[model samples]
Target: MSSTQLRANDPQIPSSADGSQGLPLLVLGALGVVYGDIGTSPLYAFREALHAAGSPSVSFARLEVLGLLSLIVWALTMVVTIKYVSFVLKADNKGEGGTLSLTALARESFRGRPVWILVLGVIGASLFIGDAIITPAISVLSAVEGLEVVAPTLAEWVVTITVAIILALFLVQRFGTERVASIFGPITALWFLALGVSGLVHIVEQPSVLAAVNPYYGVRFLVVHAEIAIPVLGAVFLAVTGAEALYVDLGHFGRKPIVVAWFAIVFPCLLLNYFGQGAYVLTNPVSEHPFFEMQADWTQLPMVILATAATVIASQAVISGAYSLIRQAMHLNLLPRFHVRHTSETQSGQIYMPQINTLLLICVVVLIISFRSSSALSAAYGIAVTGEMLITAALLFVVMRRIWQWSLLFALLVIIPLAIIDVGFFVANVAKFAHGGWVPVVIALSAAFLMQTWMAGRRLLISKTRADEIPLRTVIESLTKKQPLTVPGTAVFLTSDVEGAPTALLHSLKHYKVLHEKNVILSVVTSSSPFVADNDKIFYESFTPHFSRVIITFGYMETPNVPRALVLAKKLGWKFDIMSTSFFLSRRTLIPAAKGGMPFWQDRIFVALAQNASSATDYFRLPTGRVVELGIQTTI
Candidate 1:
């Protein structure tokens, strides 16, 4: 059966929970977390676009500056405002939004699961990881590079300072961000205010640059300079790099707060900053760092300090996002289980994954040392963002047609243009493959390959075990005829297959020659939804007087606690006592056969991943002293 089918009931679209906290505070929180990445783009996006247009000389043509500004303005309008904030945010599944959430929603709309849809989700998620790694490297690097503007001699120290700052950021993740997060909203709001004030000053000085608001200038430039359009478009995409964060963070801030923040604060500040940079370039075309150069001399140092803080907040958001994404992937069976630590008692979303944190730190450091400058790293940035956007567009199309039940013509009208824009940006970024684009490409492909291998190996192992095991009914019938010695305590044997007797239970019967009075054949299932209500969390069935089957379900976004979920069984008349209950689990040792299942290399990868997976006792939050493990050998 499909993952969505495991859900007990169809998911309900609930209202946002922001009412208790008040809209103003939620909006502030949204500004800090949701808008951090895109908010900081003005630091380097415009300058990079100018460089792509071959404007390295002292004076740039008015057409080039105006055209690039126009493109930035309209891209933000079409991509972020219309597509994501207005439309995509509404596609939340059970008040959660992400690639997998949307994928689950789309899967539920059909009677049968579609492999193509799952592939799209996997690709989107994998590319998101690539974006996660590059975002921190480039954001922090770009912000630190501002030092070069304040003192030319300090340019040599940029990379060293950036590495130190990044290392510090990752190291502190174990402590959790609950306390630090409270200040994030205020600091980021101040940063945006600074951006607006700085840009407004320049815009008033050179009011003529405001003409770039006209989309005609952008389109005309692209057509007129078709030869350089590809590279320029690639650079232009940097402005909208963090747009996906809007939808990814929908569950945290809700639709209204994020939308209000964007329209009221973020959108205007970003536009003003981009326009300010254009104005600064128009008069003093030789200025290399338009963002830092446009500022007053007295404010330059403070701007650098503020920019560094904002970029750190941005990096924090991406790192947190990676943790959430990998957790979802693990629960959905797309990846192996990793150790998940809850950093906050109040907030369920505040989780820390050591494995992910260490991986990101290493990747970000390598990218900083290899690329050296934000301008060089810019080449690697757009491809992952564009690819992820394209996949989101594809999934959005399916959702519009199947779930929303929009007419074919209407869905086409809405998605076709957006798809075309995505394709254009993707193709433009692909032209940058040789420069630095291959970094994210390689990262994404490796991630996708690992997920595929795990999934395939799991299916093979299940098939092999199913072929060898006896059905649960047969085992029960045999036990009924000649029952073994009955113990007083309860025994819960966990298994993936509800139809077959658990391997642990079979081994116990074979070796111990006894059965517990109250035996529970427990199975844990992960649904496609983000959070499951307590009412539908457990399903229980009795096959005999002593043998019962219990299924506990958890949402993909949740951390499964089998013992806690089992407590809910009391409501169904099952008297449960933790002290008298013994949890039984089968620990398999996978041996690869020389033949059928997967290629030799993939078998090795899957085996390594399995070996590294967290123990079921800890993952299920079971009492260590009350758990018993049975070791078994399996080959595929």
Candidate 2:
């Protein structure tokens, strides 16, 4: 059976939960988390366009500046405002949004399992991870580079300071950010306010720059200078790089808050800044640093400090988003489980994953040391963002047709234009392959390979393991007749396959030759929905005198506590006491056989991953003293 089919048959759906606070607070939170990446883009996006335009003998005239500004404004309007806020956010899966959530929702629209859709989802997730790594390195590098404007002598210290700051950021992750997180929203709001005030000052000087809001300037520039514009489009593409964060972080902040924050604060501030930069550039033809040049000398240092803080905030959001994405992937069996720590008492979304944080920090440091400047890193940035956007557009098309059940013509009307624009951005970025763009492509391809291998290897391992095990019913009947020595306390055997006798139970029966006074077979299931109803969380059935079966279901978004779930069994007339119950778990040691499911090399990779997976004792929050792990060797 397909993964989607298995999920469909797993559990019951719960009522949608509205986790929103008041509208004002929700918008404040959205500004900090959802808008950080895109909000900080004004720091380098316009500068990069100017650099791209001036290179290779292209003239960056006043009309060219206007054209680029118009393009920037319209791209934000089309990609972020219309596509994400107006359409994609409305297609959430049980009030949750992201590629995986959307993938699960889209899978339900079709009658049969579609492997292609699953592959698309995997590719999109891999690309997002690639962006996560690049975002920190580039954002920090760009922000710290602002020091050069304040003191030319400090240019030499930019990379060192950036690396130090990044190291500190990752190191503090273990302690959690709950204490300082409250300030992120207010700080980002102030940053946006500063951006608008700074830009409006310059924009009033050159009123003609406001004419760029006309979309005609954007189309005319592209048509007139198609050759120059084609390459510039790659640089222009940077303006909307973080557009995907809106949908990726939809679950953390509800739709209403994000939409309100975008229309009210983020969109207007970005346009004003971009227009301000354009206006400054038009009057001073020879100036390269228009962003800092327009700022008065007294405010320049403060602007740099605020820009650095904003970029740090943006990097934090990307890191947190990665944790959420990988957690979902683990629940879906695409990757092995890592240690997940809930940092906040009231907020379940505030999570810390040490392994992910460490790996990302190492990669970000390497990128900073190698690239050395934001200009070089910028070449590596757009490709991953555009590729992810393309995949999202493809998935969105399927969602519009299959889930929303729109007419063919209507779906085409909405998605075709987006597909064309996304494709244009992606094709433009293809030129970056020779100039450091290969970094994210390589990272994304490696991630995709690992996910596919792990998923395929899991299926094979489960099939092989199940082939060797007997039915639970058969074992129970024989045990009842034979009547082994009865222990005093209750025993719970954790199993992936509820139909068959658990490997741990079989080992316990074969070696110890003892059955407890009360034997409960427990199976834990993860569903595709965000949350399962409490009423449908547990199911129980009695087979023999002392034997029974219980199943507990948890949503992908929740952390499972096995013993706590068992406490609910009292409602069904089963006397349950955590002190009296001993949990039995199977610890599989995979051995690669010549005639096994996967190729020998891939099997080795799977084995390495399995060996590194977090122990179930910690994952399920089971008691350390009462749990017994019986190890078994399995050929796969």
After superposition, the stretches of candidate 2 with alpha carbons farther than 4 Å from their true spots are 1-20, 56-59
Candidate 1, 1-636: lDDT as tens digits: 111112234333324455689899999999899999999999989998999988577588898899999999999999999899878998999889988898888888878888888998999999999999999999999999999999989999999999999999999999999999999999999999999999999999999999999999999999999999999999999999999999999999889999999999999999999999999999898878999999999999999999999999999999999999999999999999999999999787899999888999999999999999999999999899999999899889888888888999999999998888999999999999999999999999999999999999999999998998899989989999999999999999999998998999999999999999999999999998888887678887877778888899898877798887887788777788999999999999988888858997789889999999999998999999999999999987
In candidate 1 the C-alpha lDDT for residue 604 amounts to 84
Pairs clashing in candidate 1? none
Q: What is the lDDT of candidate 2?
A: 0.86
Model 1, 589: alpha-carbon shift in Å? 0.8
Give the worst 10-residue stretch by lDDT in candidate 1.
1-10
Best by TM-score: 1
Q: How well is each residue in 271-387 modelled by candidate 2, as lDDT tens digits?
A: 889999898888776665677777899999998899899999999999999999998898888898889988888677788998889889999999999999998898998888998
Give all TM-scores, in the order shown.
0.97, 0.96
**Model 1 lDDT, full chain set:** 0.91
Candidate 2 differs from the real structure by a C-alpha RMSD in angstroms, to one decimal, of 3.4
Q: lDDT of all predictions, in order shown?
A: 0.91, 0.86
Distance (Å) between predicted and true CA of 87, model 2? Answer: 0.5
